[model samples]
Every structure is written in C-alpha cells, then in structure tokens.
Target: GAGVSQSPSNKVTEKGKDVELRCDPISGHTALYWYRQSLGQGLEFLIYFQGNSAPDKSGLPSDRFSAERTGGSVSTLTIQRTQQEDSAVYLCASSFMPQGSGNTIYFGEGSWLTVV
Candidate 1:
C-alpha cells in the first residue's frame, strides 16, 4: 500500500460485542503504531511494533485491547467485550526506521468505532 490503510472506516457495535480493526502499512516501513482518539481528546498511544523486536504494549488501555503485527506489514487490533467508553477513532501509522529527526510518519484515515 502507498499509505497506511485501515479497514472498516466506520463501525457501530453493540455493547459487549467484540471488534477487530486491521491496518496495512506502507511498504518498507519498519515501524507501525496504533493509537486511539476519543472525542475532543488527544491521541492515546496503544501499541507499537518496530522491526523484528518485541512490541511495545505499555500504552494499551486494558486487558481487553490487544494488537499484533504479522510479517512486519499488516497489523490487527482486537477489542473484547466492548463498552461505550471504548468508542473512539483508531488510527494506524507507519514510518521508516529512525523515527526521530526528519522522519515522516504516515497515518491512515482511521477506523471509527462507536460502541453503543
């Protein structure tokens, strides 16, 4: 993909249902990230995967949220037992190595999840 691609641009799920969001990053990007933005709130880091190393899961909100990147390209974010408070726009981004100093990270349009 030329840019970060996210699926299910809009989703409305009932409370307690499970949902899965997918992202396909730009080719050759070594770093992938998942973030959540609640209404009027700043971006909240969720997970990050860099190269072949272990993923950084420190920012995930709770046990119900989990993510994984396969083959360093596509990634999936799963939410179990979704609650109304879990509603948010999930953004996926990817960047080349050396994220610092002039590196440009591309973000997807985002998957908007509305837990009803």
Candidate 2:
C-alpha cells in the first residue's frame, strides 16, 4: 500500500447514477481490528450502512452500505447497485483498535464486484 495521503480527500458524484460499496468494521473485546487487504488504490471510503451493532459504527455510514455481525464472529458488507468503479477490491476497517495497538484495522478479501 502507498499509505495515507495529506491532500484533501475528494467526494465527487455524478447525476442520477447509483453506486455501491461494502466494509466490515472490527469486533472485539478490546476494540481492535486487522485489515488483511492492501489499499494499492487509495484512501477512498464507503457508501452507506445497515446493521444493528457494529463493534465500530464510525467506519460505516447509514446511507450507502450496510453491515452486520453474525454468530458472534465475522461480519458482512453489502452494497446495492455497485458502480463500475466499485469493481476494485473491497476494504473493511475498524476504528475500534486504538493507535499503536498490535490489532489494527482489518480488510476483507477483495469484494471483486462485477458491474455487469
């Protein structure tokens, strides 16, 4: 991964087109997480959210994507009408873990969404 950027982030959108994305916040006793995927692309983020109790609700937004905790383990991220740009690998992260902690944000396997 290239690492975080200092430049101001951009949140641009077009006309009536819809986009979708997914993510998994962290879930743990100490509020820690680990992102296993590489952010080779950039520091881009998610769309909306749907879930009751995400360990870290901060990472998710209630408008674009949805997430949920199941069976006391593992999380799910689902986005509807995914955009063509969303075809990139999906990354899930948790702000639960504090800085400097061994347990950092965790990324899921690439979403591999196809917008056909």
Candidate 3:
C-alpha cells in the first residue's frame, strides 16, 4: 500500500468480547507502531516493532492487550475481554526508520472500537 492501511475502520462490540485490529505498513518501512486515543485524549503509545528486533510492548495497558507483527510488514492488535474503558481509536503508523532516527512516520485513519 502507498500508505499505512488499517482495517475495520469502525467497530462496535459488546463488553467482554475480543477484538482484533489490523495494520499494513507502507512498503519497505521497517518500523510500525500502534497507539490508542480515548475520547478527547491524545495518542497513547501501545506497541512498536522495528525490523526483527524484540517488539517494544512496554506501552500495553494490561495483559488483555497484545500485538504482533508478521513478516515485519503487517501487524495486529488484540484486546481480550474488552471493557467499556477500552473504547477508543486505535491508530497504526509506520516509518522508514525509528522515530529517534528522525524519519517520517505515516499514520492510518485508525480503527474506532466502541465497547458497549
């Protein structure tokens, strides 16, 4: 894809259900990141993957939240036993290099997950 691509742009789920959001980074980009934004709040970092090194999952809020990057191109974020507090917009971004390297990061429109 020309830019970061995210799936299921909008989702509404019952509390306690599981949800999976997908992201496809721009071709050739080696770094991908997942972030969450609650209503009226700024983006919160969730997970980050760079090349084949260990993923930085330090941002995950709880054991219920997890993510994985496949073949270093596509990524998925899973929220298990979702709670109403989990309602938020999940944004995915990709960059040619690590943010510290001062590269441009491109973001997807984000998947809006509503737990009711």
Candidate 4:
C-alpha cells in the first residue's frame, strides 16, 4: 500500500483559529509519528503512536496540541487557539517496525500551516 499521507497540504489562518491536520498511515504499518518543522529549522518530534495508544506524548509542544489514532490506521493532530509561532509544516510518518529496530520509517509530504 501507499506510505503516510497528510491532508490540507497548506493552511493559513488568523491567530486564535484552531486547525486539525489528518494523517493516513500505511496499511499495517502500526507505528505512527508526528513531527513539526519550521522555516529553516529541523524537524521536531511531536508524538508517536504505537498501535492505538500513545505512550510517549511528552513530545507535544503544548497543551493546545493533541492527537489521537483510531483503529491503528488514522491519526489527527489539532492545535487550539493557534498562535503565529504555531506556524510550521506538520509531518506524519509510519514504520512497519517499532523504533530502534531496523525498519525504515516513511514520511509524508508535510502539511503547511501558517497562523497570521
């Protein structure tokens, strides 16, 4: 099947607006991850979902950031009362194997969000 896929490739909104980003991971991949990248900045881990549970949520930037996965296939990341600093490219990835294993993770073309 295909690799990870994210929706709303581009999003621009005024501050205080909320945004939801969706991700469709590869069929059977099981391990899903979210990352954020800002202009001229490196990717920062946001969250990781193993199966339907997120054991390492410490990566989330703030309380306004949240995510959930259903049926171990799809995930959504939501930012509430967005701020201009929240502007960045959101990326999703999936790996057939767990982290630290030899499996290669596949990344989707990031969804760009800009808060004005």
TM-score of every model versus the real structure: 0.94, 0.43, 0.96, 0.97
lDDT (CA) for every model shown? 0.90, 0.40, 0.93, 0.94
lDDT of 2 at 45: 53
lDDT of 4 by residue, 1-116 (tens): 57678998999989999999999999999899999999999999999999999999999989999999999999999999999999999999999978789789999999999999
lDDT of 2 at 116: 44
- Of the two candidates 3 and 4, the one with more favorable TM-score, higher being better, is 4
Q: What's the residue-level lDDT of 90 in candidate 4?
A: 98
User: What are the per-model C-alpha RMSD values against the true structure?
Assistant: 1.3, 9.7, 0.9, 0.7
lDDT of 2 by residue, 2-80 (tens): 2211111212334334443333344442232222222465644542222334444454434455655444334555544
Which of the predicted structures, 2 or 3, would earn the higher lDDT when compared with the native? Answer: 3
Candidate 3: deviation at residue 79, Å? 0.3
Clash number by candidate, in order: 0, 13, 0, 0
Name the runs in model 3 displaced over 4 angstroms.
Answer: none
The residue-by-residue lDDT of candidate 1 on 27-91, one tens digit each, is 99999889999999999988889964445889998999988888988899999999999999999
lDDT of 3 by residue, 1-116 (tens): 88899999999999999999999999999999999999999999998999645468899999999888889799989999999999999999999999999999999999999999
Better of 1 and 2 by lDDT: 1
Specify the poorest-scoring 10-residue window by lDDT in model 2: 1-10
lDDT of 1: 0.90
* Error at 65, model 1, angstroms: 0.5
